[model samples]
Target: QLGRCRSVKEFEKLNRIGEGTYGIVYRARDTLTDETVALKKVRMDNEKDGMPISSLREITLLLQLRHPNIVELKEVVVGNHLESIFLVMGYCEQDLASLLENMQTPFSEAQVKCIILQVLKGLQYLHENYVIHRDLKVSNLLMTDKGCVKIADFGLARTYGMPPKPMTPKVVTLWYRAPELLLGMTTQTTSIDMWAMGCILAELQPHKPLLPGTSEIHQIDLIVQLLGTPNENIWPGFSKLPLVSQYTLRKQPY
Candidate 1:
C-alpha cells in the first residue's frame, strides 16, 4: 500500500532537474541501492484530501506500461509531510527540449530520424494500448547519456476509444497543438499526437519550435502559413467546427 509507502528519506536529492505540470522533478541518488533516479515531487499542496487527477492518471498509466522508449516509474514515496509525495523514476541525462535549446548545432537529419523513430515506437505502443498522449513535444522526450530516447510526462495522457470520444482541447503545449484542437474540436484521437510528432520533426530540423504562436488564433495562422488554409474541399467538415467561425483566417500558402 502506498499509504505505508517508504519515506523519501531513502533517496538523497542531488539537484533540481525540471518542472512539469503536476510536479517538480529532481535528480536524486537512491541511498539504499546507490543508483541515480529522477524523483518527481507530486504537487498536492493545494489539495485538502487526495492526489491530483493528473498525478493519479500518470501513476496508474505508467504502472501498466513497460517499454524501453517509455520512462519508468520505479516507486512512490512520501515526504515528512502528508502532502509531500514523490515518484521515483528512471533518470535521464537530459530532455530533447533542453538539448535543442543548448546545442550549438541542430541535429542532423540522421540523428533526427533516430529520435523520431524512437518517439514513434513509443507512441505506437501507447496507441496500441488505447492511450493518447495528449501532450507530445520535445520537452516531454528524455534522453539518456547513451542517446536512447524515452517518452516522459504522462500527466496529460488518457485512454481513448475507437469511436473517438470528446476530450479537452486545452491539453498539449500550444506550439505543438494540432489544428483540430486549435479549432476547438474536443474529439481526441491518436491523430492529435501525430500532429505533434510532425511539429517535433520540423523543430528537430531547425533546432527550434516550428510554430511559436502568440495566441490560439496566431497558432492557427501559423499552421495556415505552413500548410495553407483548409477548406471543406481539403478538410471535409472544416467549416462546421465549433470555433471555426470565431476568427477570420488569413489567405496564405506555404
Candidate 2:
C-alpha cells in the first residue's frame, strides 16, 4: 500500500519540465534527501470525482514496476490545496524528443545504438512481466546526465494474459502505429512496440520522424510506400483485415 502522502512543501520547484497527457511535470529539489526529482502534478480538477482513472492506472503500475531502465516513482506527495497531488519520480536531464529537437548536432550511430539498446532492455523487462507499453514514443523515453535511458509514462500501459485480450487500436500514435494496428487489429502484443522501436531507430538516424503521416489512412499509405504494398504472401491474412477494403492499395513490391 502507498505510504501517507507527503506535502509538496517539502520540495522546492525549479522549473517545469513538460506537460504529459495526465499532468504537468516539474523539476524540484527534495529538501529531505537533498536530491533532484521530477514532480508530476496530477491533474485533478473535479472535486466531486476522487482521482482520474488514468492517474490511478499510472500510479498502480509504476508502484509495481522496478527496473533500471524504467523511471522510478519515488512516492506520492500532495500540496496544500485540495486535489493538488504530485508524483515524485527519478530526475532525468532530458528526454529523447527534446534532445532530438534542440541538439546542435545529431547523435552518432553508436550513440543512437546505445540509447535504443537501453530502451530495448527496458522494453524487454516490461514484456517479460506481461506488461505492454501501448504508447511508445520518443518523448516518453528520458535520458539522464550519465547517458542512462529510462522509459517513462504508463498511462496507456496494461498487463496482458497468455492469450492477450482485445485492445483498442487507437492506443499508439498515428506515426509510430504498427501496420496490423492500422488495419484495425484490436489485439496487441510486444510486436507493436517493436514496430515503434523500428521507427524510433530510423528517426534517430535521420534526426527526424520516420513516418509523419497526416492521418491514419495517410500513415498506412506511407508505410506501404516505404515497405511496399502488403499482400497475403508478405503478410498472411492481410486481405481479410477490416480496413483493407478502404484503401486502393498500389501494386508496389518490396
Candidate 3:
C-alpha cells in the first residue's frame, strides 16, 4: 500500500490550473497542513452515468503504486453541485510540454539525459507492474519543485496481460507515440514505451516534437519518411493488420 494522505475536504481549491482531454486540473492547498495539491476535475456524465472507466482504472492502479517517480493520487471526490468526479493529485509546478514550449534555448545534453532517465525510471516501474501508459504526451509529465518527473493522468492508462491476447492496437498520444503503435503493430511491449522515450529525448534537443504527425496517416508518412517504411522482413507480419493498407504505399524502398 502507498503512504497516507488526508481526506478530500482537507484541501482548499485555489484556481483552475489547466485543461486536458479527460478533465480540468486546479491548484489547491491543504487547509490542515497548508500544502498545495493539484485537483483534477474529471467528467463522468459524458460516460453515461457513475464513474467513467478511465477514472476507475486510474484510481485502482494509483492506489497501489508507491513510487516517487509516479504522481500520487491522493483522493477521489464528487462535486457538490454537479456530481462531477474529481481526483486529488500531487501538486506539480509545471509540465514538460509547457517548459519545452517556453524554452528559449534547447535543453542541454545532460539536462535531456536527466529528464529522459527520470521518465525511463517511471516507465520502467509501470511496465514492470504490467501497466502501459497509453497516453504519454509531454503534457502528462509533471515536474516537481525539485525537478523530478511524475507520470500522471492514467485516464487512458491500462494494465495489459489481463487478457493473454490484447485486442487493442489504438492507444497512446500521437506525437510521442511509438512506431509499433503508429503502424498498427500487434503485441504490446516495453519497447513501445522506449520508442516514445527515444522521441522524447529527441524532442529535448530542438525544443520541438520529433514526430508531430497530425493524424495516423500523416503520422505514418512522417515515420516512413524519417525512419523509412517497415517491410515484412523488418517488422514481420506487417501486412496482416486491418489498417495496414489505410494509406497509399510510400514506396518503402524510396
Candidate 4:
C-alpha cells in the first residue's frame, strides 16, 4: 500500500495545527489538486519497531470508515525517509477545544444540540461498524467553517466482536473517563464512549470541562460527590471489579 501512496512532498504544509499523543497535525495544501487538507505526521521517533501498532490500526480503520460526521482519511503519504509517514485527512477549520477556549460566550442550546447530534450520528455509525472510539473528548472533535462537525483522532479506537475481549482501562483522558474505567473494568464496551458523550454534552453548555479530576482517586471522588456513592443495589457487580477493594467507599447515600 505504501508503494501506491503519493509522496508527502506533493502537499505543501501551510501551518502546524495541533499535536496529540500519536502525531502532529498540519494544515496543508495538496499541490496535485490544489485542495486544502490536514497532514498528520505519524510519530515514530522512539519506536525501534517498523511502524507503531496504533498508527497501523488507525490507517486500517480510517480506510474502511466513511461517514459525513467522521473525519475523512484521504490517503497515506510517505515522506523523503521511509519512517516519515503522514496521513492525509480532510481539513477542518477548528477543533472544539480551541473554539471553546477562544469563544467569549458559551454555545447556544440549539448549537450544542446540533453538535451533539452530529457526534452521536458519527458514534452510532462507528458502533454499528463494531468500532469503539476509546478516546472521545472535545479536542478530538473538529468543525468546518460551514458548521459541520467531524470526529477525529482514532489512535485509541478498537473494533470489538461477540464475546468481547479485555482491553486496558487506562485509555481515555482522565476528565472524560467513565466510572467503570476508573474502577478498573477490563471489558470495555460502547458504554465508555457514551459516558464521555455525557461529559462533552455537559461541557458544551458551560464552556468548561464537566469533571476536571486531577487524578484517578480524585476523579472517583468527584463522581461520588456529584452522583453519590454506588452500592450493590445501584450497581450489581460493583464489588466484583478488580480494583474495587483498593479504595474505601464514602458512605454518602445515593
Candidate with top TM-score is 4
The reply for model 1, stretches above 4 Å from the true place, is none
lDDT of 1 by residue, 116-215 (tens): 9999999999999999999999999999999999999999999988788888889999999999899999988999999999999999978878999999
lDDT of each: 0.93, 0.90, 0.78, 0.95
lDDT of 4 at 236: 95
Instruction: Output candidate 4 Cα RMSD.
Output: 0.8
Residue 79 in candidate 2, Cα distance off native in Å: 2.1
Pairs that collide in candidate 3 are none
Candidate 4 positional error at 8, Å: 0.7
Query: Worst ten-residue run, lDDT, model 2?
Result: 43-52
Highest lDDT among the candidates is held by which one? Answer: 4
Q: Write the per-residue lDDT of candidate 4 for residues 135-169, one digit (tens) a residue.
A: 99999999999999999999999999888899999
All candidates' TM-scores?
A: 0.97, 0.95, 0.89, 0.98
lDDT of 2 at 43: 86
